[model samples]
Target: MILITGSTGFVGRAVVERLLAKDELQCVAVAVRRAGPKLSERVVKHVTGDLESSTDWSAALKGVSAVVHCAARVHVMEDTAANPLEAFRNVNVQGTLNLARQAAASGVQRFVFISSIKVNGEATQRGQSFMADDTPAPLDDYGVSKMEAEQGLRKVALQTGMEVVIIRPPLVYGLGVKANFAVMMHWLQRGVPLPLGSINNRRSLVSLDNLVDLLMMCLKHPAAANQTFLVSDGEDVSTTELLRRMGIALGHPARLVPLPASLLELAAAIVGKADVAQRLCGSLQVDIEKTRRLLGWTPPLTLDQGLKKAAEGL
Candidate 1:
């Protein structure tokens, strides 16, 4: 049996649907914060309100062989919490370890952790990419929490012998994608002129379908045990190109203003949006050679294919 947390989330919902489509509903269970209509009637559901260090998981972990942990206190643009790092740690670190420890005690064989590339760092050098084994250099509270969770999970693995597979992916987009990716799609569809035309920095991205595929592989692949993997679409593109492609996919063709990247950065800094400017003009890439070589895997969808999917309902 497989137990999945955050089953109502963007990624977790997709994972659950995939399992159902494979006629594995009888073998699947989900841990949700509350009982709701988001899940199907046929699949097992367990309500384990707001993940934290003390949440009970014995019921949810019962008879489960593997676990796919997709829950986390995600990053936000403007955090309202007084202690953001502590808040993140409560869920991303403490909650994760609590569940993992219980799962290990229950004899769960494998644990698949869905981590972010931010655990490596904010950006990488132009030609250099983040490798799976690179020293973790998390920049923000959310990233730091994830890094801590990874460390704790490794310790649990060493002590309890539960196989833990970690997968760090870059920006993930698909049909139901929200946040910055959705905003970009909305802008393109509306033909809003953007000042990202001159940006030439490359950023790696992985589609939701590709990420889910990799998660499926890690579930049973022998080579995935106690390994950290980086995943992407195996293609990198510049901010301008990505917008252009998204525009094309949306059938609206982006209206790009060829503004200088430097001027844009300066303006953004003046407005206290330097981080936003960095995301738009900076480079962040991940090398997945090790993932491919070890798992004998490849992203099923190409960048164009994934973009088309993401554009479908936008």
Candidate 2:
């Protein structure tokens, strides 16, 4: 038996599905704050529990061999909480500690944490890529909290002798993905002209298919124990090229204005969108060499394949 938190989320849902596809995995249990939307029959149990509080999860974890912690307060737009950092910390940090403590008490062996590359930093420097061994210097509250959670998990591992595996995925995208990427897809579908064509910043992105594959591998892979892996689609794409490809995938000609990034940054700053501009224009890359050498695994889908898959869902 295996326990999966946030099983209804996009990545979590993919993990659950992929795990169930394996005949060797008998039971799959999920902890959800609310009654989960209907899932396939393969999901054996749905346990209702909040990360903030403890419930009787021993029944769910009785013989659970592994636990995947995927629930977190993800960064979002226009959140009006008095302290968004505290709110994020409460869930991403405190909540994760609660779950990890419980999993340890229940004798769960492997704990897989699905964290983001933001925990390392917001972006990478020109011609430099983030590596697994790099010290974490998070740029945002979300990343800070994730870093704290990783530390807490390590403490639990030290106390309980449970194996901990951390996966840092960059710009995960695919069908049913909401947020900025989805908005970009929608805008391109509507033939909106974007000035990002001139931006030469390179960003590493991961497809949901490839990310899910890595997570499944981490569940039982001997090499993944006590390791942190940086995962990507293994291809770097610039903003302009990415936008053009997205347009093609959406069956629309790329309608790019090709404005200077400096001017665009100035305009966005005047409009109180400096943060947004930086994110869109930033270059963030992750080196997946460790993942390749350690796990001997390769991402199966290419950027074009994943983009077309996402476009098909639009």
Q: Best lDDT goes to which candidate?
A: 1
What's the distance in Å from true for residue 235, model 2?
0.7
Q: Please report, in order, the local distance difference test score of every candidate based on alpha carbons.
A: 0.94, 0.87
In candidate 2, which residue pairs get closer than 3 Å at backbone N, Cα or C atoms, i.e. clash? Answer: none
lDDT of 1 by residue, 30-107 (tens): 999987874576579999998999999999999999999999899999999999999999999999999999999999
What TM-score do all the candidates reach, one by one?
A: 0.98, 0.96
**Number of clashes in every candidate structure?**
0, 0
Give a tens-digit lDDT track for model 2, residues 1-314: 88888888989888888888999877688777776566767676656567674455667677788999888888786778899889988888888887788888888889999998988998888678999879999988889988998888888899889999999999999978888899999999999888887988889999999998999889889999989999999999888989999998899978999888899889999999998887778789999999999999899999998999888878
User: What's model 1's lDDT at 107?
Assistant: 99
In model 1, what are the clashing residue pairs, if there are any?
none
